[model samples]
Structures are given as structure tokens and as C-alpha cells.
Target: MKNPLILLALAATLSATAADAAEVPLYETGPAEDSSFVRFVNGGQQPLEIVATGSNARLTLDTAKPASDFLPIRAGKPIEGALVRGGAKRNVSVTVQPGEFASVVGLDDAAGGLRTVVVHEQPDDFNALKASVAFYNLDAQCASAALLAAGRNIVLLDQVPEGQSKRRQINPVPLSVQLSCAGQAVGQPLDLGTLEAGQRYTVFLVPAGKQSRIFQATDTVAR
Candidate 1:
């Protein structure tokens, strides 16, 4: 009952809509990133739409308006007692194949409250991982830096250009590294309780009596 010209036009519109739907967005399979807003990181290969509520969130590649569509579950928000936004959840995700996994991070008002959380929904392989909240001061300047031990790895995260000190730091402490050496440490770790605005300390990762072991400082941030 439609005119020929109108029928052709309708077909083209439908085709374009379908193409847009097929082109997955960059949100999928990328580490969680937030310019100023907090969002969940999506880990699936296909881009997903995020649904967030007061205390619940989920990600799916289904692209359906509602949950009753054909979206596969890639990740999920924490329940009541997990390690994220105070065991809540964070916005950090990476693109993951069906059997692979990735993590996301959440930032707080204070650098001392930054936490990282890993999400796995019906994971194909490994389970989820979570690290306690590690605090950093943006106001302090980095002096010298070093690794904790022979086998431990340290992650010096990006700086917080917009913090109280106008400079912030995020770093990781590997548990595998022993916390001390012959009464001296490679550093004095960030001790939040005793620190002022521009003070700095180091944490020493003493070797476990292993000699001739070389230490590798991969991602260390020094000011």
C-alpha cells in the first residue's frame, strides 16, 4: 500500500539503523575511564549499554532496550560486601574475549581512598580479584623510586592533576614482595595517617635472602 519512492526510503533507513546497531561502540572491551563521571567498565567484545541504579549496575552487548533481549552477561557490580567503592564497585573495564578477563577502577574525592575492583560474570576461566584501597597524595612530589624486591612488581599509576595538591599519584604494592630488609627498605610506602600535604615516604621490599637477583623497575613514577 506504500508508494514506491517511500518504500525505498523506508528500507534505507532501516538498513542504516541496523548498521549502527551492529557497529559496537568503544565502551566495550576497554579499561574503565571517566573524565569526571563514574561509570562501570565493560569487558565484552561487543559494546554494551550500562544500566545503573542507586546501588546496582550491569553491562551487556545485547543492545536491547530492556533486559529481556539477547544480551550476554560480561560483568556485574558487587553485591553488599565486596571490595570496590568501599566494597561497592568501580568503573574499570577492559575488552575481553569470551574466555578472558579484565579489571576496572573507581576514584574517590580523596586520593587516600582510591580502590580497584575486578568483575567477572560467570567467567569462562579465572575468578574475580580485588585489592584494598591504597591512598596517594596529589600534593606531594615524587622524589626517587625503586622496586620492593627481586620478584615483586610495582605499578606507578597516572597522576591526579586535579587534587588538593594539584598533583596526585596512584601506585600498587605487590603482596609477593617482602615488606622489609636488613633493617632498611627500598622505600617508605605511602603512610596516609602520619603524612601532611607535601610529605613523602618509601616502602622497602627487602629481598628474601636471595643474592645475585636482579630487580626490575618497570613502571615507577618519580618526580
Candidate 2:
């Protein structure tokens, strides 16, 4: 009869190989221009090694890390990209139109792997006296929410759906921001002393201990 120990060892080797395939990195390449920008966000449970190929850029991001600012890259046609982790590799394909603002996010897949999506940001006329902000709903548990500017009747965003982002313009003044869901407040309002005019910001809502929370980052937009 075949040795049981040998069979067990073979099974272990095959299992390890399957695991590696499940975590392989994704890669791709595309044309791009300087008028465009690329922002990165990590929403997956496992950390990742972010590599922007054909552009010479890389970043290491952990779970729920704040969105990266619009990063400038040398305009290149057929630019390559890759997301690597656990010694596995996968190729990513991306294309940015001229004057386009975009963000790429890493998310968790249903199978405990990684899923990536590219978000095209909307552009608006600059308000020299106000600041613009964008909100992205990435929390799997938070279906929707609203953004209220303190003392203002403005609803910056209403029913922002999950896995998407919304933008609004706010006055460059001291104010607090609050979030509400299902007709009730989730947490304390954030006191933003004042926002700088002509600057852009992006906020991400993430899961935190049975509740959803937020983190903000500045974005560099070309005039």
C-alpha cells in the first residue's frame, strides 16, 4: 500500500500552491497624461504593496488608510500597474482621460481575496471663497448616510450609496461636519475649524467597532 505520510505531504504541497494562486498580484498598463491625477485607497483587511508601473511610483498601505493625494506622474502611454501582496502578483489595467481626476481603491472580495476598482472624480468650477469636498462610502456595513455642515441648511450629500463617492462645495469658514443615517446620528460631529479655499478634500467612511467612521485627505487638483 502507498505510504500515508507521503500522501499527506503531497496534499500539503498542493494546498500551498493553491493558496499562492488565490493571492496572486494583478497587473496592467495604459496610456496617461500629466493633466490627470491618480489617488490610491486601501479598504481591504490585508495590507498591500501598491506599485504604479510605467510611472515609477509605489506605496504600502494598510487597511482603511486615508486616501492619497493626487499624485503627479510622468505622462506615459501604456503605463503599467501592479498590486502585490503575500508574494503573489496580479496585473491591473487603468486608463485616465485628459483632465480626469481618478482614484483607485483596493477592497476585499467575497472570497477573502482582493478586488480593485477605479473611480473617476468629477470636476467643478473653483470657488475662490470656498473649499470643495468629496465623500466616498467604502464601509460594507454602512449602506448610506448624509453630510451636514454645522449651522447650515445644506445637505452636502444625501443617501450616499455604498462603494461610491459624492462631491459638494462648502464655504471656507469654521464649521462642523456631522453624519446621519436612518434618521439618527451615528457619532459626534467633526469640528473642522476652517477649510482652505481652492483646495480639494476627500473623505472616506470606514467600519469602526460596530459603527462607521471617517477619515479625510487633501487632493491636489490642477487649476
TM-score against native, each model: 0.20, 0.66
Please, what are the lDDT tens digits per residue for candidate 2 over residues 26-94?
110122334555656665546776665444345666744444445433322333467766655556766
Stretch of 10 with least lDDT, candidate 2: 5-14
lDDT of 1 by residue, 160-186 (tens): 221211112223333333222232343
RMSD of each: 19.4, 13.7
lDDT of model 1 at residue 67?
15
Model 1 misses residue 41 by how many Å? 12
Model number with the top TM-score: 2
Candidate 2, residue 9: Cα displacement in angstroms equals 42
